[model samples]
Target: MSMFGAVDLSSFAPKQGSTPAEPAAGAAHNGRPGGLVVDVDAQNLREIAEGSARVPVVVVMHSSRAQASVDLVDLLERLVVEYAGSFQLARVDVDAAPEVAQALQVTAVPTVVALIAGQPVPMFQGSAPEEQLRALLDQLLEVAARNGVDGRLDLDAAAHMAEPTEPEETEVERQAREAIERGDWTAAEKVYEHAIAQSPADDDLKAARDQIRMLARMDGQDPVALLAAADAPGADLDTQLAGADAALAQGDVNACLGRALEAVRAHTGEERERARLRLLELFTIIGTTAPEVARARRQLATILY
Candidate 1:
């Protein structure tokens, strides 16, 4: 089952071959001080959710027909400005993106949900006092930190000034960048993997490989399906491994490592050794410096001796 529940959001995905409706004039801030607010629809919902991999995105679903919902939107906008880009606010007009709202199972107007690493964490429905909302937001930030989603948008830039362009890239870097842009994660990974193999000592290549691996893991499979398969009674080691990868992809580092550790404790002899090796491989993917990796290492040691 999904951490969020039995909701299958794939059904709500924008239909293929249909053009995405453009945002209304003034609905999006091109570049403003604390540019953390954006109007979202079914077409852009996936992109906004994916952005949670970098920073927590608070999605507010509301209907323009309701005055209360409009008031809630105004309040959220003010809060986003006050928060100074600590988190982004994605406003979803229910009338415009009913599919998106239905996917989230919104029973009423002005439902708030937080997306952390592409997974939804339901916040609340309807409006609350500013003080209570701030407390809830504070808690959300804490959750974001624990999941390694602690990133902030640049809030100090002036809206009137033109945004700076990125520097040009090398041939290989350009290839990888384009592949990533096109959502060809495997192709991008191959590029980085080959570069790392050619120059094993290049820390930059190694870092790039790790980052792509994480992205590939996230984009590789559906977390809910993987979890269900792993939970099956007759699930083999391979199934368990895939589930662990899915968890890691969803930014549940602890769940990923904990599942592997459970395997280590459950199996023995050759099977145990295989689990141990797989856990070590995951450690490398997560990086040696991560607190989750460190904690898993200690747990592994305890399980061994």
Candidate 2:
């Protein structure tokens, strides 16, 4: 059985001519190495899946006509470059690779699945918020770690080609980095907070503050313990909150958000308000623009009013 559930895609095979001719060397977008992102069809699907023994392979089933599909492809491509080859992305056009889609049982245009040691682990369907996707990828890495599939691609060439020169860091940014290095999150937070207060309109400063706050919340905490406590019978709201914080620190955005939302539904009066307010704060940490936040925001409204 696949990690997500039982999935039998072994019988499906890509029809001939459905596969595109292999691209010449350096023909991929931005001259990315072939190992980073590869178009997969029935012919090479098994080979790529088996290669997951070395590194996690993210299979993205997409359609050309859907704007959401296009957006997801772009996001995955960006993440591929950002992750520097922690995993390989297998881009499968559903229309052209129906057998592959059938094998995966994809019911949506943008279904993502992870492969490790050739076993499929379903990830998500449709367009997921960027932050949520990042969290999911982090979890995927953890999964890879457990399975001994730890391999990193050399991204120096790609990074050099994509990154542009930047100005020297400001003194405040320098102080923040220094404080972070010394494990003084409070000092780091204060630096970013002060910078934000001075600028008042700098989104970058606000983002930095948010990141530092999340770091502080999870600092010196054991995530496994927190999660265990949160799941214990008769666990209190504070314990769950701690679990949520630890989850956020570990880049499990869904777990973080879900815990708070559950608290909101379970508590009442001041307790409910506390959960609601905390949820709002998490939304800020995750950025209000994320689709998960948007969905959670709507759900919050329904709970409150």
Candidate 3:
């Protein structure tokens, strides 16, 4: 079933074999204050569209005359900075680039579109709540990754975020990291498990243990297909649990917890207990300090009582 509801967008795909335009001279790849935000016009539309071949480009079609559009663009600019080059933001002033807007069949201001591999995907129109937009972006990344558009923008070259000093890994953590690099997931999981068992009160070790377990479960698996299977009518508990793992595998912690939470909400007796335990596993994966984990914990507490 198409999510866009009869709005055919296939025509928006870039023409086949159209050579991608090169970046301008002296471009520092997000050399502006708005991070990866770039102004798009008739002249640059092809450039921006073609650039999607490398990384997903989020096109924000807006009008300067509208305060809502202005506010949305500002919010998107901040979001681009926060995302650390997950995607490039192409700001198209519909007034200035009327031809571009008309070509894309935009009837309103503040239309948001995602271009992945030169295929235009309709996202939303008008402004959205920050949390909602964040969720959408996560979903977008997951979809893009499944379609083999897993390229990431060079965050090191981004101007928005300041570089941070990386902490030296402890010996045990280093061993576990090496094991993971070697595809010895079981060994990596065991290393963390042994460390956590020795230092029962060490929260960091416990978190690392959970992370290792998550990576082990997600190894070389299609998390998207797992999610789709779980969403199938009358899906079993095992499939639902696997879907939760898939969500975490793709970096959507909310969806990971959400799948288990939904199972808990829909089941009772032994099934609900299993679902509850699964949610607890995800909580451990993210840790208590994570905002999403905290919120999910609250939701879980509310559901239980």
Candidate 4:
């Protein structure tokens, strides 16, 4: 079994009537390993071989005409970026490079091969997730290290593989947005949470999530109900705070401000602090245009003085 489901050997061998040829410049799977991508054709044949000779290269061959193949290519690109610091990714259009395709014995529209030292080794065809691909890469690296090629290529592989994974992040964000657009608030929330969990420190994901949160607040909840519940006469600090939080969650900035101020007026230090922090978050969400932001800055200066 391969990292992606079960491995199918049908895609490994060359197609019928295809003859194996000696590795040549611009030849499918022919370029020298242990170096940067040099031959355009060869480079194209192997998705990523240069700078990753010791790490093994995953050549993703796809037909541009096939929708599934095209999608697989895009996913592969995302995986390349995600594992940029670990492996090299190169693409060969089977339709464009027919001989190379024939040489690789590709019978399918999308085939992915792991090549080490200029030889095709374990391969998986079809679309595989990034996690699965990474797993295979880890296994390949371990095997290579055991084979004595890791030490010489470790640094080079690391350097060659470090590409931005933001594209993947963006794709995730887009899917979340689409979910929200489809009125699937729970699904959207889950996706957004996943994105945040995966990258808690990511400012972009954080910002995008803030937008989603705002949208979620406007969906079914009634802002007035929350505010009234929080402000009912003689409400305890905790109850009021919960109500204020609900208001904030419903995108009711004014209600949050009023409830927070009421809590402060009652001499509730803890509630005051919570409201203050929530105010800061509100400003962050609403951006810098709020007059309260400037007032807050001046008040900070006065307090420091």
Candidate 5:
């Protein structure tokens, strides 16, 4: 299965290339074999959002009062460990966070959704057997890898600390990454663009290019300044779009998408079409499977019609 559609772990693992770098000392995956699972609530939802930018957060909306939900959670608790640190889990009791349930529109007790890069991905709204759950999770890992999200969380303080290792990159990617490290956005973008032109079907190259493009847009721009300019009284469409770009560059995906949607409603004619196109571009960058993209798509259509 493609998982998040047309994307797989190709971005995460190093494709066999010309040269291989020696493994660094003390490189290891973060967290223990048990994996990192957090008990989340409405008050700490920010934790889930922030963590998703680094890795996928599996949101398990369940009711402790429901035996089925309890059983499902226990099953998941056991399952997450087997994957090591591929993805972390977050469980929210509907009884404790009814507002969270309402916001997610979760109609069932044992709903499971994934938050990837601050966007929701609806998994399912009810219980499934362990076999099915395992299959879905396997697919999720593929999606995570494809999206370049293979981060690890810190283990409990009592446990020994181990730093996560970066995946090896193709030689061309190494060149691009070196450019990025040296703060040469133009060079990095050119590297990926050239490589992509040569290997047109390489999803990894495409992802790398998108990342460099975003970085180029964000280059030398202060987030606070951009946000202030956007919030200035009667800020025009261009200013707002700039602010939205800054937001997306800073991992504020919701704000970035929201600003574009607002622009669509607040403008008319050519400007409105620009806003609509911007939203579509963002959908492409973030992956159309994102729940945020789906919601914004509906909102854009409504506004257009």
Candidate 6:
């Protein structure tokens, strides 16, 4: 069952009466950046167990002889690099820090514990996939965020993976952007419609599609004819917004604004917000100095509220 090679480490015991040791030079706390791997000798181990009474300490217990332990250390290193902001990651050699190891009752090469508010909270033990570790970190982060710990969960890092970060763009999105760039509203419409089939979570992609849909809807000569031919009847979602984009490009601000407003009526939640955002972006592109900019800002305020 061991992902790493088998090493029967069921008999290792922490030496008696050995006080926790000091961090041997580079011992980092909770994966904080630049926290170095410290030798978990007696003095460091005790310091970890009792020092730093404010921030929680995550103690990783490992055995050098165990291949699994080696692998766990490697994984911890990766987690630290990516998520050091979450917590400090420290390791203990059950072999060296016997007293402290005995105190924690660590029998395995790799055991993880989260110390929140200076109390030990158990995490994964043994080698685990990086995804699992990341998940655990996220759970802790959510708690940290709710508790307002450590300054708003590091927004920069959270934005990289948080729900608010734009979703993944689909092939539909790529095709749509291409069409728009080439000034081919017809082709743009088709690509955006296809993209909606995949419906990637990125708000920016959905916003782009909505812009195109708005444009397509307003391209005169055969307004109803175009919508009837290309856009679905009940499609007031992103694809419809793509048509609106086409309309805007054609200089039909009235129709573009109308379709965008209807999109607000038809779609709710994040999609509605995205539609509103597109219109605002349109306002900027067309020049905020214009009268329409003020109107668009009002609309954006209504939707956001």
* Candidate No. with top lDDT: 2
- Lowest-scoring 10 consecutive residues by lDDT in candidate 5? 18-27
What is every candidate's alpha-carbon RMSD to the true fold?
Answer: 16.6, 11.9, 15.3, 20.1, 18.2, 22.7
Residues 1-305, model 5: lDDT tens digits: 11233233333333355222221233333322223677777787865665565667888987543445788789888876776666788888765566687677665567788876656677776568888888888877667666655666544531354434668778898899899899888898899788878889877577557656766776777867988999899999988987887766544456888888998999999998987877766776655565667888898889888
**True lDDT of residue 190, candidate 4:** 80
Best by TM-score: 2
For model 6 the TM-score comes to 0.36
Q: In model 4, how large is the Cα lDDT of residue 200?
A: 85
Runs off by more than 4 Å, candidate 4: 1-52, 151-305
**Residue 20 Cα positional deviation in candidate 3, in Å, after optimal superposition:** 33
Q: Give the TM-scores of the predictions, in the order they appear.
A: 0.46, 0.54, 0.48, 0.36, 0.46, 0.36
Please, what are the lDDT tens digits per residue for candidate 1 over residues 98-146?
6687777765666888887677787877667788888888988887777
In model 3, state the lDDT of residue 267.
84
What does candidate 6's lDDT look like per residue over 1-305, in tens digits? Answer: 22211222122112355333343333332222123333456666555444323234457777543456778778876675566445556778664455555666554556776544334555666667877777776765554444323421232442343232466876666777787788799899677556656666645555555556545555443444444432666775766666565554433444556677667767788987887777765654444454455676676577657
Candidate 3 local lDDT, 1-305, one digit each (tens): 11232334445434566644454554444222223777888887777776676567888888643455788889988988788777889888764566687778676667888887677788888668888888878877766665545555665555545434579878998999899899998898899788878888988787677777766776667766998999999999889988988766544556878888888888889999988987887777656665667788888888888
Worst lDDT window (10 residues) for model 1?
Answer: 25-34
lDDT of 2 by residue, 78-101 (tens): 998888788888899865676788
**lDDT of each structure?**
0.72, 0.74, 0.73, 0.54, 0.69, 0.54
Candidate 2 at residue 198, lDDT? 89
- The CA lDDT at 302 in model 5 is 91
